[model samples]
Target: MAIIGILGTPYNTVERSPFWWNKVSYTRQSFIDVFQELGHTVIVLPVDKTENIKNYLPLVDKIVLTGGADVSPYLYGEEPHAQLGTTDPIRDRFELAAIKAALEANKPILGVCRGLQLLNVYFGGTLYQDLSLTSSQIKH
Candidate 1:
């Protein structure tokens, strides 16, 4: 079975023993289901300290960046407009490092939703300030 590294959704945390995790992906479970259906092993990686991504990246054959949060507008070089959504700065840094690590390691990389935006930014590209206001009119 191909070992695939699936990034985990970052969640809000609670203050106590019953600390809670926030939901960060629309397709995390779905990806797991589909991957298992295809007979592959899925390894989930949650947000780790910025310096530790390399510890996990090398153990997998491929990297999959799942969707969640708003990509910080600053990342793509734009100021945050009123329409900008929630942002996860920690996850942003981690994923950026992960993607770069993936490239240096020469592993296959798959990105979804915000992941797509991150990839674009990492490659010296910019994002559409507003998808609906851009050339395409499809609702996300």
Candidate 2:
């Protein structure tokens, strides 16, 4: 069975005692279920700044960039637009580094939504801050 590494998103929670807690989350259950159904093992990779992702690369056969927040505009040398949604710079940095390491190791990548955007930016492409900014009649 292929071992798949899935990147997670970050979220915050407030305790009943007025204390705040931050956590890394992977909300998409379908990703895990579908992969398991297809006979692959799923591993959720949390947002970790201390761990060396390269060390984990040898354990996973493929990487899946799950859907999440908009990528930071700074990565592509642009300023954030007024309509741009929330971004996680920490996640962006981590994923970029992970992607690079995975590519160097010849690991296959599967990107969904924001993951796709991140891949584009990593390869020297740009993103439209907001789909509405475009004059196209089609709505996103």
lDDT of 1 by residue, 81-116 (tens): 876678989999999999988999999899888888
Model 1 spans > 4 angstroms off = 14-27
Instruction: Report residue 87 deviation for candidate 2 (angstroms).
Output: 0.5
Error of 2 at 80 (Å): 0.7
Supply the global lDDT for candidate 2.
0.86
Q: How many backbone clashes are present in model 2?
A: 0
Clashes by residue pair, model 1 = 11-22, 12-22
In candidate 2, the residue pairs with backbone N, CA or C atoms under 3 Å apart (3 or more residues apart, or in different chains) clash, namely: none
lDDT per residue (tens digit) for residues 23-113 in model 2: 6466589999999999999988877673578777788999999777899999999999999998988889888988998999999999999
- Best prediction by lDDT: 2
Minimum summed lDDT over a 10-residue window in model 1 is located at 17-26
Off by over 4 Å in 2: 14-22
Compared with the true structure, model 1 gives a TM-score of 0.86
